[model samples]
Every structure is written in C-alpha cells, then in structure tokens.
Target: MVTRRLVLSAGVALATAQLSAAKVFFREHFNDEGWRERWTVPTKWKSESELGEWGWTVGKWHGGDESNKGIQTSQDSRFYGIIAPLDEPFTQDGDLVVQFSVKLEKALDCGGAYIKLLGGEVDMDSFGGDMPYQVMFGPDICGSGNARTHVIFHYAPKNENLLAKTDVRVERDRLTHVYTLHVKADATYEVYIDQTSVRAGRLEDDFAFLPPRQIPDPNVTKPEDWVDERRIRDPAAVKPDGWDDVPKTIPDADAEKPAEWDDAEDGEWEPAQIPNPDYQGPWRAPMIDNPDYKGEWEQPMIDNPDFKEDPLLYRRCDGCTHVGFELWQVTSGTIFDDIIVTDSLPEAFALAEEGWARWKDKEKAMWEEVSKKEKPEMPSFGDEGDDDLDEDMAAAMDEDWTKEEL
Candidate 1:
C-alpha cells in the first residue's frame, strides 16, 4: 500500500516536470520600470531626428490599474523601430502562437500598429522595415479601405512570397484590445480578437503554398476549327419588312398652335416629338439552339511539373527569435503591451483574459462617462480682461466693461 506522503510527493514532482516542459518563448506585461532595459531603439533615430520616439504610459486616461503601462508612439508623421530578444530561439517542434494588446486612442487615422516576429540574426540597433521577419501579426489602419488586422508569414524558400489573409480587421477604438494568431502544426490557422475567433482556415488550402496540381499542357493549343459558341442567331428566322421602317419618334398629332402665336414672333411651329409606340428596338434574328456548337474547348490538363506536394506546409514555420515594432504614424498614440510568443494557445488566451477582458468594461464605462459630460459654456466678450487688445481697443473695451459692471 502507498503512503499518503508518497502520493503527495509524486503529484508535486509531476507538476514540476510539466511546468519545465511547457514551451513559452517570451512574455511581457510592461509592469516594471525595467521594461526600458529589455527593449532596444533603432540607431537611425540619432541621424534622422524626425523619426518618432517611444514612450511608456497608460495613455491619457486608463480604464483600470495605471500600473499596466504600454509602449506608445509619441510623435506624428514619423517612423519608429524597436525590438526585444526572446528568452530563447523557438526551434522546438510545436505550434506557433503570437498575441498582444493594442490601444488606438486617437482612431489611428493612418499608421501600422503591428508586431513582427523576427528570425535569424537581427541587428537590434538598426532593425526596421528592412529586417526580414518570419511572422507579422497585428493591426494596420490607413484611410477607408486600408484598415485591417494583418496576419502574414514568410515562405522561407522565397522570402518575397508572403502568406497574407484579408478577412480580419482591427478593432478601432480607445479601449485596449487583444489580437491572437494561432498557427497549428496540422496546417490550420486562426485569428482571434478578445478570445473570439474572427478568421480560421487551412494554411495549405487558403494560401498559395505550392504550385497547382494540374495545368494546361504548354505544347497543346485549342484547335482553330473548334466551334465553341453555345448559342447563335437562328438562320431560318426572317426579319419583318417594316421592322426597320418604324420611326423611334414622331410629332404629336394632337398638338395645335397656341392662339396667341404670331408668324413674325415664332418660326414655323412644329409639334413636339413623342416616342413612337409602334417602334421596337433594332431588328435581330431570334437566338435559338446552336445545334452545331461544340462545348467550350478547354486546353488538355496534364500533371503540373513544378508542383511538389508539401504534406506539412504549415510545418515550414521556422520559429521566431525576436519581437519588433516598425511603424509610421500620421496621427500618433497607439499603445502596445501584454505581448506573448508561445507554443501553447491556452497560455496566450489566459493572458488575453487577464489583460483585455479585465479592462474592456472599465474602459467602456470611462468613455461613456466622458461622452455624456456636458461642455462648459463659453464666456461673453466683456467677462474678463482682454490683454491682447490694442490701446484704442483696450480703452473702448474698458468703457464697455465699466458700463456692463455699472
């Protein structure tokens, strides 16, 4: 018989082992002042002073705990680049999950608030738009038609070829919202916002993962004599003799010249033309069964030589080494925080619940409160001192003020 202590010890040991095996690439809440140390700014900002700078804050007004600070873009019409290294390069065999929180307090008229998962050796000091990344996930807003939540991944064989889906869009608001991208080993993917799934599809089926399975044989061409038209004018039908003679318009026979009209004042009067009721449209032979027509000719399909089936198209994910933000904002103030890169979807979701779900209602309440508050009435001209007035205007203003006070 096993003792109770032994069972307790075994339970604790199992839990410890499981914890060690869990794959968490990186997680950041930005709760500590030391967050500045963990992230790096691009070197180009030194020479190019016009570029935006990053600031840490809970925004002008935060919903909940002010301690939950996020990195925000602090300048308008400028570029920004910053990156942070993960605890380790994610190379293990597992699914890829990236998640983060964003707050667009200013509506983000034009800008990108996306985060990139960079692989290989990335020059942290100069990381910008040019640094090749393995995955990019987040929101980008520009004008009317250009607003969307980007879910893109690089094809390693051809870096230029990126897998991008066009379904999900950014949650445009002043509240903190979560964005999650879960790419599974079985070649399926999903994009979730605030724990609710907005888009899901099979990676191999949705994206151009490989060359098509079949194609038209290059050497073969459609025969010149092939009659592919399905319908033609009936040769037996004949046009009516008067079909073309009918006029489209004719003078109204009921019209009589006005009694006041004079020959000298008006040119020869003509009744206004009206649509001819008898007129049919242009004459044409009726369409009938095309008995001699061959069906649409298709080029003979042969097995495509270039297509090589990838049983594991989704498995091509090489993993990520660093998380970076490269952006250009016309209207600044987008906060990014609560980022996570992990192999476990549940872990990412848990963060979403804690970070986003907790603050959503409070933010909404705050927004409604501000919106309902009444604006203060503007004061009249004689209410107070108008120091900027010229000498003559000032004397006249003083006389008006004295009269009003009296």
Candidate 2:
C-alpha cells in the first residue's frame, strides 16, 4: 500500500522538475537564412586592432581553420559576422535560449564571440546601442586573468555592464562545443557553460552601478523621469469649444408638421396620406438600434480586452457608426487576415463561464464523496483488563455461561 507521505514526496519532485523544465522558450538554430536580416556588427566591434577586420566570422560547419575559404568575414576588415533577427517580439513574460557552436582558431585571440538579446530596437546595430532591455554574454565565457573568452551581461542599452570580467575556457580546438544562455523577460539572466549552470541573478539592481548614458544619438530618448511632451496634446486643441464643439440650434415647436400628419392616428399606424407608397420613389428603410449599445451611438464598445483600451478606439471620427461586432483570431505572421471570426461576444463569454462552472462543481462533488465514505476503524488501546482470566479459569467461565450456571 502506498502511504500518503510517499505520494506527497513524488508530487513535490514532479513539481520541481516542471519548474526547471520551464526555463527556455523558442530556440533559434541558425541552420538556415531566416534570421539573417536582423543582426549587424556595431562600430565598436568593427574597428581594427581588437580583432581588426577579424571581429566575427561564420559559415557552414567545418573543421577548425581561420584560412578556410568558406568563412565569411565582417565588413571593413573588422568583425565580419551575420546577425539574425527574431521573428517575434520578446516581452517581460517570455524566455529566450540561444545556443551556438564556436571553434576558435589558434591565431584567434580568446576574445570569444558576443551574443546579445535586445528589445526596443528593430535593427541589430541600433539594438544594444540604445534600448531599454539588453543582455550581453562575454565575461561568462572567459575566466579572470585569462582575458581570452568572457561572458558579460549588460542591461538597459548603452552597454551599462550589469556583469563583466567572468572568464570562460573551452577545451582547446574542441569541435562544436555548445553554449547556452537563458534569459527571462523579467530581467533575470543565467549563463550555462558547457552542460553546467553558472551565474544566475537579477539584472536591474546588479547592473545599476554602470553609467546611465552611453549611446551618443542626440535624437534618441533615454528611459528617465522626464515627461514626454510629445505624448501630451495641447488642451485647447481638444476643448469642447474648439474642434469638438456642437453647433447650437433652437427648435421651433410650432414648425409646419409633415404632410402625412393626422391627429386621430396612434400606435404604429402608417402615414395618413401615402404620397408615394406604390410609386417607388426611392424608399428608405427604417434603421435598427443596436440593443447592446451603452456609450454614444457614434462609437460602439469593443468587447476584446486586448484592444478595448487602445487609443485607436477613441480617435474615431464623428458620424461614424459601428455596424456590428466581430471576434477574430488572426493566424498569418505577415498578413492582417484572420483565421476565424465570430459574430457574438456574449456567446463566447457564456461558453467560457459554463465550462468553468462545471469544472468547479465536479471537483467539489468528488471531494465531498471522498470525505463521506467509510474508513476502517483503528485498533483501540483504551482497556488493559483481565490478563489473568485466561486458560482454565476462562474455560470454566465459558462453560458456565453456555450452561446458564454461574
């Protein structure tokens, strides 16, 4: 029989394994040309003397040789390597895992290659150059005093070093040694050297000591406490008396009535005089009011939570009306087309609510049934009587009780 303690221990072990398994999402293998357009070599890495013209290199998998003709060199005789762009955006809730194979040539100084994950910039050169979130790996590859291979972590653009000077070494001329870097969207980063995990910590506070300003672009904005004047519109431009004002009109109550007016007519009657009922003189149909409408008639409510608060909803022009509502599930990566569209919002909400209600009810009923079921009685240790009333005395008492003699 399985004990409760044993079951609980198994559950805890499974949970721990799940947490560790959730570390990375979406790994990109540069085996093809899909990511070629997203990366670029920055000027710092492009200059000579450091690696000078030899900053970066890439090609089809081959045995070690810097002179291999297939290896592509960086532009301007500097680090010549390709940068690949991610197909999707990374958010604070996402995780990225980057793995690469590097075999350094004997002449190649242990400078090691750099892999950077960045946001807020679409282009590679503009990525770490100035952005809100970035992670650099160099100091972690190289060990202290080794100065050859390093894995570094830099946060918030401007290359403000969150971590630096951690030296890493690989077995010399090792073929295709794989390195993995795990980064959480919440500013937590970890480095894995070979198969072992190393250096895991929060990025924001650790990298706070570096210089706040590094990018030289005067036009680019930095993350700071200052207000964004561009986002704030002039109050006068949006005032009621300005563009949004409604023209004043005083109605004359005694104005001439319509030609079909009749005093005796009431309750859904047709006009008294049919001016052109069968004449077919461009008849206009009656308009139906949307039953679910809440706000102004010109602007309808958007039921989708993702787009409800979007500014585009409030910028609609006057006199525009929502004909109907649609729920769309978009599928294509490069197109605005949707895979499915539904006509009713309430139907979706009702279905979701019903599913949740049934699930909760079933769980409650199962637990209640388990509690009510009978359990085996435990042996009682309440009495310690008549140890000596055994053997012959017990036999004589049993016979007397059977014969009704005492």
For residues 200-319, could you state the per-residue lDDT of candidate 2 as single tens digits?
A: 665433344333323334444544543333333333343233422322333343456666766578434332342322233332343444343343222223333222122121111112
Candidate 1: Cα lDDT at 21: 63
- Scored by lDDT, the top model is 1
Runs of candidate 2 exceeding 4 Å displacement: 1-26, 33-77, 94-96, 105-107, 123-133, 139-149, 157-159, 165-172, 184-189, 200-406
Clash tally, candidates in order? 0, 27
Worst 10 residues of 2 by lDDT: 331-340
TM-score to native of every candidate shown:
0.77, 0.34
Per-residue CA lDDT of model 1 for 1-406, tens digit only, reads: 4698899999888766655666888999888888889999888544577678888988765676889898999887889888999999886366888999998765576789999988888889888887788788899877555678988777866555455645476787667788999988888898998888988988766667667789999999988899888889999999999888999999999999998878787977888999999999898899987998889998999999998877657753475789989888876778998999888787787677787787788888886675454333322445457654344433322222222210
Candidate 2 accuracy as lDDT: 0.34
**Clashing residue pairs for model 1:** none
